[model samples]
Target chain A: MKTAALILSAVLAVAACVFLLAPLVVVVLASFSPTPVFDLPTTGASLRWYGRIANLEGFWPALGLSIEVAAVSTALALVVGTLAAIAAVRGALPYADAFAALLVSPLMMPGLVLGIALLQYFRAVGFDAPLAGLLVAHLIVTLPYVARTMIAGLSRFDFTLIDAALTLGCTWRQAIFKVMVPALAPSFLIAGLFAFLASFDNYPVSIFLTDVRTKTLPIKMLQYIEEAPDPTIAAVSSLILLGTIVLLIIADRAVGLSRMAGTSD
Target chain B: MPVTSLSRRTLLKASAALAGTVAMPSIVRAAPKEIVIGGPAGAAKYFNESVFPLLKQKLGVTVLYEGTNSLTNLQKMQADKAAPKFSVVIMDDPVMIRAAAEGLIVPMQASAIPNLGKLVPGAVHLDGMWANYQLPWAGIAYNTKSGAPTSWADMWAPSHKGKVIVPSIQNTEGFWNLLIAAHLETGKPLAEAQYDIDAGFRKLKSLVPSLLNVYTNAPQAMNLLEQGEADMIGGQFSAYTLTRKMDGAPVDLAIPKEGGFAMPSGIAKITGGPASDLADAVIDAFLGPDVQQVLATKAVVTPTNLTTPRPAGYPDPATLFAPDWGFVAKERGKWAERWTTELL
Candidate 1:
């Protein structure tokens, strides 16, 4: 009975992986097609579509804007979210669970609803700066990922180690720096990764906030797809997929894959 | 779990360093001497590649094109009313009328654009607040294998039922579909179709059995046609059919003998802008006979300027019916709800 269950579980896991990765494999193959349309190449693969990616009107500026927004928002969310997590876990304020849920509520709201609401709110409040609006919107989008991961990390932590270090030889600040920070390193990495990825690929929210001079990569890609339905979008997706894989590999090497996968818990 | 014995100070330092690298310089550059134009994304590539250089040479001012859907453009215009961003806006005739009514755009002086006289009377809309440079018709786009559908009633035939895609009322083309249905049902000229809403909705409901799906946009309809999922598409833009056919797709547009609806696309000047003279010059260039001819041949739209001859393959502009866009615009909200309830 045990053997049968083990075999069934193994088969299910493999099937799940295939189901998730099949579309990605098709996208990668379509990217290399020599044709101008969205057909997979039956004869020979070509890099023509990849070559056209750089020439897409406004490609460079959009890429630059996307990276900047993602990096800045991720950094800001990490600091703010980590501090909020610490307060909720250690400070033991009244209604701490409610506070945490409020912080993460943006995740549950539909992105289009959030976008339209933000657009109307910004207009009502007389906020006209496009880049600043985009940054704030992305920060809202990314904060939940950081806060959720950090809260989980902090709940399982033992704060007694910091007190022990203080009694031994270190000051309060020194104890936090010496013990708590290193112990939460995996959480920090995982949270930052998720936060950055979320901000980088956001579309529905960015669409409402962006003006002509300021557009994110996802918005620009949508425009490209509408203007011309070609293999160039597939090429861009393939590159993004490749970059994500590299990021995941580095993450797995830094913290054991099982821990990053949250399997041990 | 065995924790790695890494120094907390080192991790903190590394994170701080990573944060530091993300700092962006907030440099404000001088605004350029450029006229900003807002329009649809599907037309942006054509404008940038073919029209910008012409505008620069003719008007001696740089051009910046911002691409977005027409409905979003209307919202943006409303939001930016205090300090309008676009020098010139391009949209369907109905949207231009709505914008004019909201005081978002200003009417043009005939003397400012002399080329306006060159266009046919039907091409001028909203009391010269805007002028239609291109006439993109809405009709049935069909696969060659569908035995060549030639009339709107062809969609309701037993053989064609369940193999047709119609645009949702939210799209400009969808509004045209409503007008066409009204025209056919009432046997009224397209101009008179606006007043018979009941007849239109009843006719639209009658065709419900033919619908494969109601698409919300042009691209989705085009995709369905390209994939052969639908044998014919109702209220599709002729330009998209032309583009697909040029790309080797076995598709052709059919402007039924009952007549198709002509959607006049035009450019309007925003109420306040520093580049009014340049914007006027650009609009005139767009209306020039040579430019109109180029638009007809290259973009597959019917030219509005009478002097510019029609392209060989396209339907004649005079033959297509013109719906009352102003009336349609005013009644669109209630009609859209009716469409959803009765048709979809």
Candidate 2:
């Protein structure tokens, strides 16, 4: 019975991996099609779709905006969320749990609901700035990831290390920088990675917020698909997949994949 | 190369170049020769590739194009009412009517656009507020293997049960379903017919059992037909349906005996834009014979410009049943709500 259960579990795990990764594999293969359609090439593979990605209308500006928004939001969320997590874990404030929940509430809310609310709120306040609005919206999106990860990390953290460092003649600020930060480095990397990715690929929230000139990559890609259902989008998706793989590989080297996933010590 | 070794001529040249740079801004700022326009992404490709160059040659101005949907354009214009970001907006006729009422767009003199005289009758949507550039008809799309539907009401026929798809009322294509349903229930001409909300609802609900799927957009509906998941898709247009057929899909579009709805798209000038003249010129170019032909051939839409010859494989624009735009613009939202709440 035990052996049978193990076999069943292994099969289910393999099936799940295949189900998730099959679409990505198809996309990468479709990107090499000589034709403009989304179907894969039957005759031979071609790189014309990759070449077309460079010339796709408004692609560069959209990519640049997406990167800028994600980088800025991730950096801001890392700093603010880490401080809030520290407060939630250490400060012993009244209703600390509620405060933590409030900070992470945006994650629980549907992106569409958040988008509509933000648009109305922005309109009521008479704020028409697209770039600034996108930054604020993405910060809301990414903050929950950072806060949740850091909160969990801090809970398991031994605060006595900072105390010990202080007693060993480190200044209060020095003790935090020298002791707490290094100890939480893995958590920070994990939090930053998740936050950056969440912000980078955000669509539903960005849709309501994006104006014509300030379109993000996902919106632009959708527009491209609407305009022409072609392999260029597949090519772009393959590139994005490649980039993510490289990023994960780097993260694995630095922090270990198991640690980043919170699956192992 | 030292600062002390700088020649008099070089210093004079540097001073001259700096002066030109300072004066260039004022010269360029006095009469800005560029206009910003917004439209759908696919349609924008046509204007960018075909129309903009001609405008630059003839009108001596550049066009900055933004790809967007009609609803988003209206919302943006309303939000930026104080200072309009888009100089010209291109969208559907119903949206044009709503925008006209909201004062997002301005009425124009026929004299401003010579090509306006060449348009088919009733192509002027809201008098001078906007004009229809394309008159695409919405109807039923069926896979040939499933057999052609003879009438629009045949979508609900017992034979097609569980083999039909319908679009959600929120989509532009879906509006046709409501208009067609009203026509199906009432024998009166579409213009004389009311939305007949109750009767229309009854007719649509009766057909719900036949629906294999409900789609929010034309692409989703067509995808079902292509994949053989559904046999027929209502609230789709011949332009897209025919285009797919050309791409070797087994689908074909039919204007039912009751006739299909005319889903005309229009272009308007932003009311308070700084570049209204350029916008007018662009509109004129869009309505011109050459541009209209290119749009018809490339976009698969029927041109409103009467002088532009029909492209191959296009249906007759005269056969389409056009409803009252004003009524549609006013009641579509309520109908869409009812559609979602009362029906699926």
Candidate 3:
């Protein structure tokens, strides 16, 4: 009975992998395909799409925009979310549930809705087309993901250690800086990673908040797909997939894979 | 009496002083330094890849071309209304008309585009929008080898239920599907179809139960048919033909008896963008022969401009489903709402 179950489990895992990998596999095939549209690659594989992606001028601009947005948004989310998480977990403040919920309002709201809401707010305030607008929009969307993960890490923290430090005549700031900061290390990085991933993949907010000048990679990708369907898209998608996989591997080494995968924020 | 008079005068003077302290925005003489233009991903990428090089060389202004679905693009417009980020957007005629009504898109100064007259007659001001680029028909495709289904009526067959796929009539597909339902439900020919929101709603409600699945975009429809999970589906010609010929998918289109919808995507030029000149130039370049050919060859679509010859590797437009643009523009929103109430 045990042997049969193991074999069944193995087959199911392979099937699951194939199901998830199907679209990417089709795209990889199409990227190397000679015919333009939908032919799956059978015999000769060429670097046709890779060449197209390299040659397209939008490649660099969009890539730069994505990296910049992800980096900035992650930094902002980490700061704001970390601060918020600390306050919540410490329970030193009043009405913590309400505060936490208010901070995470963006998560409850759909990205499409949030993008529109922010646009209206921006317009009403007469501030449009600034990097600050995009940064704030991305930060709001990414903050919740960071907060959720950081909250987990904060829970594992030893309150007794914090109390012991305080009783020993250590100031509140010192106890926080040394004991609490070190305790939240693993979770902090995970929060940063969530922040980066959320901002990197965010399309709804980016679409609404961005003007033509401030457009991101996903926005540009959508443009290309609508007007022209080509193998070049596969190349771009493949790059995104590769970037994500690399991050996942690095994250696993930095923090345990189980924790990273266990509670996806 | 003297004290009261003095206090009233002082209050008036203080109010005036506070008003004078408010800051005002600066005025610009030359058009701002850049223009924000937006379109579907394909159009935007074309601007970024094919046209921007020449535009930068001549116009000397940076043009931002945002690309996405028509509905999402509209959402962006509504979202970025404060400080009005994009000065120009390319969208279908009906959407542009509705957007104009909703006060989302701004009207252009006719003289800004010297070639406005180059637009086809009846298209000069279709719903107050000048034609930037004319798109062709959107309709049905089904597999012939799988029992030879022909025409649109066969799509409603019970056996094909759960095997047939059409795009969701919410958000993106909502507008077009509503128009189709209006025509089918009202029994009105293309000529008689007008903006009847009530009729459109009733039609869409009836059509909802007939569908097996309501897809979101071109990809899912094509995927289902390719895998033989679905035998029939609605799609743009771009992926449908590509999948049939190249993917060797057992799927082909059944031309509908009711003329399919032919719509045009146009860029509305607004005053705020500094790169308006560049934006206009880019629009001209998109309609140019070389780029039009590329679009035709790559997406299995034809150039809307008559001067440009059809590129190789696709069926002639005359042979494909005929679309009535006039009818589509008139009844777009009514049908869209009807679709929302019925299908979604």
TM-score of each: 0.86, 0.79, 0.66
Error of 2 at B195 (Å): 7.2
What lDDT score goes with residue B269 in model 3? 56
List the candidate numbers ranked by lDDT, top first: 1, 2, 3
> Evaluated with DockQ, which candidate comes out highest?
1
Q: List the residue pairs that clash in candidate 2.
A: none
lDDT of 2 by residue, B1-344 (tens): 32233235435654554454344322233235878887755466556666777778878887777766677778878978998989888888778888988898998778988888889998876567888888776778988888888898888789889989887776577777766677788775676555576777877888888999887545556656865678899878755676666556668888778777777788888998877777888889888887787677766689988889887756777777776667777888988888888887
Which residue window of length 10 is worst by lDDT in model 3 chain A? A222-231
Pairing residues by index, what is the TM-score of model 1? 0.86
- Alpha carbon lDDT at B203, candidate 2: 76
Q: Which model scores highest in lDDT?
A: 1
- Any runs in candidate 2 off by more than 4 Å, and if so which? A18-51, A83-105, A120-126, A150-184, A228-232, B1-83, B144-159, B169-172, B175-206, B243-252, B255-261, B330-334, B341-343
In Å, residue A14's CA in model 3 sits off its true spot by 11
Docking class of 3: incorrect
Error of 3 at B177 (Å): 8.2
Q: lDDT, candidate 2, residue A9? A: 100
Per-model interface RMSD values are 6.0, 12.0, 13.3
Worst 10 residues of 3 chain B by lDDT: B21-30
